[model samples]
Structure formats: C-alpha cells, structure tokens
Target: MALPGRSVMPTLGWRWLLIFSSIPSFLLLLFYSMVPESPRYLCMRGQTSEAMDILEKMARVNRVALLPGILVSDKRIELDENSDPSEAAHLINVGDGRSTVVSELESKTGAIMALIKLLSPEMIRPTILLWLAFFGNAFSYYGIVLLTSELSRGSSKCASYPILKHSVGSSLYKDVFISSFAEVPGLLLSATIVDRLGRKFSMSAMLLVSCGFLLPLIVGQKEVVTTVLLFGARVCISGSFVVIYVYAPEVSTRFLV
Candidate 1:
C-alpha cells in the first residue's frame, strides 16, 4: 500500500514512511484526552463520582436511560494490616441505599500497581500465559513477514517453478503487497467466527492451522507452492492476532473478584 509513495520519492521516501507511520500515535495523543478513563479503575481509586459521570455520559451517548443511584460509593473503608495485602482495599456500593461490598484490591497506588496485581497468586498464571502467547505470535508473525522478501528472490532450484519464471527477481515490495492482502480475509474470518467458536477455540484452531501451513515449508517445494503456503500461514496468524487482542483486556477485568 505504501510502496507507491515510497517509489515516487526515492531519496526522502523512507523518512516520509517513518513520519507517516507515526501519524496514528500523534492522533491518539491529540484525542485521547477527551476519552474518559476506565470507570472500574476510577471506582477502585475511590473516585466513584467521576466514574458515575463517565457512565452517565456513556448512557447518554448510547441513548440508554440510567436509573438514579445505580452506582453509589460508600465512603467507609476498613483496613486490616494483618490481612493479605491483596485484600487491603475495599470498594463499597450503596446503590438503592443498601450497603454492599462491591470489590477489593490493594489500595496503595504505585507505578507498578498493575504489574503487582497481575503477578498476584490469582492472576500470575494467566498473565504469564498471555505474555508467552503474545511473544510467540509477534516473533512468528514478523519472522514470516521478513522471510517473504527472501522468498521472493527465487533460488536456482526454483527455476522449474512456473510462477517464479517470469518474476524471479521481484522486488520485496511486490511480495509484501501480495502477502498483506491475506490479512483482509483473516480479519473477516475472525469477525465472522470468533463469537461462534469462542476466543480460546478460535485462537487454538487458527494457530494449529497456521502451524500446519508453515510445516510444509520445511521441505523444498515449487515457488508457487511456497508462496501459497506463506499466504495461508499469514492469514491464519493474522486471525489469531485478532482473537488474542480481544482476549487481552478481558483477562485483566474478568479475573478480578
């Protein structure tokens, strides 16, 4: 997609690409201030009024009528030093004027409060698993993307491959452009079946299918076959990424008691 612009401005092309790539981050910085903070985080910080305001805003935006006193916070919080530190903080809800314990966590806010919570006994296993999943996906996805350029430079053995005969010395951009299209279908596939198959099943199935496609590449094959395998692998990997990203945020909030 960016190849055309890069090809036009040969000298400053790479610089322009780098600048263009940063536009999304700049836009996020400019507009993120208007976005409301997470209501759950606000409530945990004893800022229930602010959280309520944000929730009201959300309700209004969605045109949903909100009941009065739906999210009241009780000012009372009891601290017990002898108790586990994880149980140090308490969030009390007095919705309908009936007091109830809504949630609890470590009250002290530190730079690494989130990390501390994630590494807690309850969250540690899933946190580690999520980290490993993300690391493996990123490593494999980029490794395959980088390998596409090398594959495009067909080897002498690939001379017999009809698909590479005409475009044996194709540029890196051409191969990238072709392989990148796989992401479109990959995204569509995820969106279509993620809900039906569920996140765990969807991710596992995609990873397994992607692995199946990748395994065949170990043996020498026709360049056309290799290209097809690469495309298929990219598609499955892209789908897995969609599922994992959706799963990431849910991991933190869902496990909270």
Candidate 2:
C-alpha cells in the first residue's frame, strides 16, 4: 500500500513518500485541537467551569441533553497545600459510575514513585505480558509480510515436492498488493466487536486464532495453500495487534488504580 505512494511525485522521489507517510499524522494533529480536554483532567486541575463547557459542547454536538444529576456536579478542589477550600474548583460525573474530584492537585514530589510503580509487583506481570504480546504480534506480522516472496520460492529441497510446482514468484509484487488489504477486514472486525468482546478475551482469542492459521505452514504446503494461510495469519495478527494496544493501557490503568 505504501509502495504505491512513491510513484505519486516521482521528481521528489523519497521525499514524496515521506510526505505521504506523514500526512496522516499531520491531519491527526490538525483535528486534535477540535477535541475537548478530558473532563476528569479538567477537574483534576480545578477548572470546573471549563470542564462543564466542554461537556455541554459534547452533548450539543451529539444532539443529546445532559442527564439531570450530572451537569458537571460542581464542587471545590484544592490545588496546593496553601489553597483555600472555597477557591473555585468543581467535579464532573462522566456517567462512569464515578466522579472526578481533586482534593489536591498531585504534586511533583511523587513523579519518581509513579514511574517506579510501573515495575512493582502489581504491575510487573501485566506489563511484561503485554510487552511480549506486542513483540510477538509485530514480529510475526512483518515477518510473514516480508517473507512472502521467499516463502513462495520455498527450500530447494522442496523443489522436488509436487506441491511446489506453481510459478508464484513472477507475480510476487501483485500478491503483496493483494495481501496488504487482508489486514483491513481484520481491522474492521476488531473495531466492531472489541467493546462487546472485552479487551483481554479478544486479545487472547485473536492471538490463538492467528497461531492456528500458522500451523499448516509447517507442512511445506502448496504455494497457493501457503499464501492463503499466510494471509489469514496476517489478518489475525493485525486484529490482535490493534486490540493489544487498547488492552495494554487498560491493564496499566486497572493496576495503577
């Protein structure tokens, strides 16, 4: 998919490719400012009115009215040791069955402890597991993609194998183009079910399902069969890869709390 962009502005060569690659990130930056700050973060900073304004904007944009009891649920928050209780500060209930309140804004003194806590016993297991999952998912996904042509060629020992008779090499680039899209359906499937399936279970299921697709490759199957399995594995890995990112932060947040 990215290969096609290099042909767009031939005069600039790789520069055009760089620009094309960066366009998505640049557009993300352009749209990011349009998003309101998290109301919880606003409450943490003692900016209750601003948070309420953002919630109102959100409700108006979504064409829904705010729930009766949850209009910022205004309250005071102290920002520092010397701060007054009556100083302008507020809390907002975001309908998560919890309200954001800032008794005191977190001081800079605990920054080191916060970083160190990520390696503590409660966090160590989940953090390490998520890391391994991400590493394996990326390694297999790119490994399959990069090895498609080589896999198509097969071992010379397999040259004598009847299943190796097909001439898949000459059209390898076309296969790459076709294989690139195999991840899209997986991405869409993930987006559709992730919330309903729950993060941890979905991640585990996708990983296992992808591994199932990889098993047939050990038999040195026919080129057509090999390609199909590889594409299937890539699709499953891509979906798991997307979920793992969402799942990791959830793990970290749950542990930290």
Candidate 3:
C-alpha cells in the first residue's frame, strides 16, 4: 500500500492510494463472477444435475477423475455429531440420478425476518458487541497509519533533532512502509496461535496489546520512539483485525445455523 502510494501519490494524489489498494480486490470480485456457486447450495435450490456437474468439474479441476457413476452427496441430513452413521436420516442418492433435499425458503420469513431475529433480545447483545469489536479493531489499526506522518514529523518542531526531519507525506509513506512489516509477524502469530487461544480470547488479547502499545504515544515522546510504538500498536491491531474478520462469520453461525 505504501509502495503504491509512494509511486502514484505524485500525480494521482494521496486519495489514489485507496483506489490502488482496492484494485486487486475489485479485480478479484470481477473474476469471482466466473466461479461456480457451491454445489451444496445448488442442491439445496433443487438443481441437482447442475450440482453434480459442478462436482464433476471440480473433481477434474484438481486432476482427479470422478468415478464413472459416483457423485457428490448434496443431501443434508439432520443428525447430531454423536449420532451413529447408520442412524443418518434424510440420506439422499448422489449418482446418475440425484435425490436432492430441496429447502423451501419462506419468502415472508426471509431477509426481514432474519433482521428482526437479529434485533431480538437474545441476539442484540452479541451483534452489538461484534460491531464494536470490528469498529475498535479497524479504528486503532488505521489510526496509527493515519497518524504516522504527523507523529514522525514531530522532529520538525525541534531544530536540534535531525534524525526525524523529513517531509510529512514522504516520511509517512516511509514509516508506513516500515511499520507494515509488523503485519507479517502479527498474521503469522494469529494463524499459529489463534486456534490454541480460541478466537474471542485471541481477539481480546490483541486489542489489549494494541492499546497497551499506544499508551506510550499519549505522553510526549521522540519521533523515533513514537514511530516504533505506533508500529507495535499497528502490529497488534492488524493481528486482531485478521481475527475479527474470521470471528464474525464463524460466530454468526451461532445465530444463523
């Protein structure tokens, strides 16, 4: 991001950084349109043949040939994890002929109903907390980046400090570029330890650490120290941000599933 900003900010201006940063995801979204829908969803929609065709296509995609007659079972069985395999109910055929489990979605009890359910007493607290977690993670992560230029330029106020005397924009990009390395370690730590600590706990720890690192900056500090602490804070926030993205979807299943 900083590299692209540094390269393009001259003509396109700083705002262009957001555009350039988003180009990859925008292109990915465009490319995603070409991808097939989940086979399970197709079966749920009662398009068993299409779902089977997709499964076959997927089997071939990874250089694995599907058996001449075998197909993916798209039937959803309502069974507890502890239930015996022989006790599986609603089993459906997945072969040349599909026994699809078509789920009839009630139109009247769809999106609006889901929204209403979300606002219900049982869900309201979790939903609001989830939003606050997302907001805090994003706020602190970007706050450091946004303040990088100003924080680094504190040297300009003191003629005696030569190490931190750089133009705000350029210094910002430089600090951001350097601080960005923190995300690599942060993400690696999250990936390696999140499972052990559990998602919620890991997120809490990250948020605490992020806030902890930011405390030094609240009181006056040298530009170098400020930049380093800001980097540490960004590191923790970035790690928590990663956890937050995965956490919402996984946790939402408690309500939706």
Candidate 4:
C-alpha cells in the first residue's frame, strides 16, 4: 500500500509509512484507560478488594454468577513445583483453622526478586529456552527478510537491461511485498493447529518444516523456485514465531509481562 506513495514521493513516502504505522500505538494509548487491569496483579499486590471487584465485573460481563468466598484476603500459599503450572488453584491458609481454594496470588515483589524467581531452579530451564526461542525467531525472521534483497539481486529482471537504474529497487520492493503476504497464511495455520497440537509440538513442527524449506536453498535454483521456497520457509518460521509468543506466557503464570 505504501508502494504508490514511495513511487510518487520517495523522500516523504517512507516517513509517511512510519507515521501511519504508529497510528495503532496511538490508538492503543487512547483506549488503554478502557482496558481492565489484571486481577491477578492486583491480588498479588494485596489489593484483594479491587481484585474481587474486577472479578465480579468480569462475571457480570460474562453473565455468570460469582461464587461466594473466592477472594479471601491475607493468606500465604506455597506453590508446588510438581503441580500443573497451568492450574490457577491457590491454597489459602489464613491460620484461623480454615482453608480456602482460590486462584493463585503472590505478594508483589521487586524487579530483582522477580528476576531471581525467573532464574530459580524450577524456572531456569524454561527461562533459558524462552530466551533462545525468542532469539532464534527474531534472528531468523529478520535474516530471511533482509535475505530477500540479496536473493533477488541476481534474479532481478532489470539486471540484464542495465539501463533501468530504479528497476532493482522496485523489484526488491516487489519481492519483499510478496514474501510478506506469506505471513497471512502462516497466522491462519498457527491459529488452526496451535490448540489441537499444543504449543511445544506446534512450534517444533513449524521450525522443522521451516528448516526443510530452507535446506533446498543450499543448492542453486531458478529465481521462481528460490522465491517459492523462501515463501514457504517464511510461512513456517512465522507460524513458529506466533507459537513461541503464545507458549512463553503459558510457561509461567506468575511472570505476566
């Protein structure tokens, strides 16, 4: 969509694209006040009443009744590592000869404390894996994007003409635009298979498939074939990227960023 602008007004077009891209961020800022605060965070900070109110509001919005005694204040609960991390069950032991089962809540800790918790024995492995996964995704995604120009340079239709100075730039943009469209299908595929196959399997599968798409590029091929393979690889890598984002949050309930 920015192509027309770029063609018509080369200098200002790129700046306009950036300005338009930031519109979503501005929209988010405008609407942020309407977004609800995390009830879990509120509870973690010992604002039990606020959390309860939020929960009640949520229940009303969902047209469901709030269960009585769901948010008893001033309770210390120890999370068991062996327990299912997905489970939100928080055991509240108030030391009054009574116990209640509710959603988990931890006392608000400082950034250093949170970092320590993330690096603790139980969390270290997943933390490292998440870091590596994010690193790989970002590295590979941008590498592939930047690689488009280099890959197309040799195959540029304008290469033989030698007369069209702007042809190379236009061809590069076209290749980039085409490759970017692969993400649409990638997103659809991620959404379809993520729930059915689960995050770990989905991410691993996509990465493996992406590798398969990339391996053929080791040998020389025609321009069309090369672009097709790159498109396929991008689709898989993009899907894996989506899965990683979804998986990261599920890995730790406490580390809600």
For candidate 1, the per-residue lDDT at 147 reads: 67
| Model 1 clashing residue pairs (backbone) | none
lDDT of 3 by residue, 41-120 (tens): 65544567888888888888867877677444556544466863342233444333222323223434586788888788
lDDT of every model, 2 decimals = 0.72, 0.68, 0.71, 0.73
TM-score of 3: 0.58
Model 3 alpha-carbon miss at residue 22, Å: 11
TM-score for candidate 2, please give it.
0.57
Could you give candidate 1's per-residue lDDT for residues 1-257 as a string of tens digits? 55655555545544655575566679898888798888776656557889999999999987898886767655434436564223344444335422332222223344368778889999999999999999978887887787676666654243344234434333344556567778879999999889899998998899999999978666556666877888999999999999999988887789864
What TM-score goes with each of the models?
A: 0.57, 0.57, 0.58, 0.57
Model 4: which residue pairs collide?
Answer: none
Model 2: per-residue Cα lDDT at residue 203: 74
Per-residue lDDT tens digits of candidate 4, residues 1-257?
55664466544544655575566679899888888878766664567889898998999987898897868656434546674322244435454333221211233346568889899898898899899999998888887887777665554342343221344544555566668779879999999999899999999999899889877666566667777888998899999999998998888774645
CA-RMSD of model 2: 10.2
Cα shift from native, residue 163, model 3 (Å): 11
lDDT value, candidate 3, whole model: 0.71
Worst lDDT run of 10 residues, candidate 3, spans: 96-105
Model 4 misplaced regions, further than 4 Å: 1-109, 155-167, 254-257
* Candidate 2, superposed: residue stretches over 4 Å from native: 1-112, 155-169
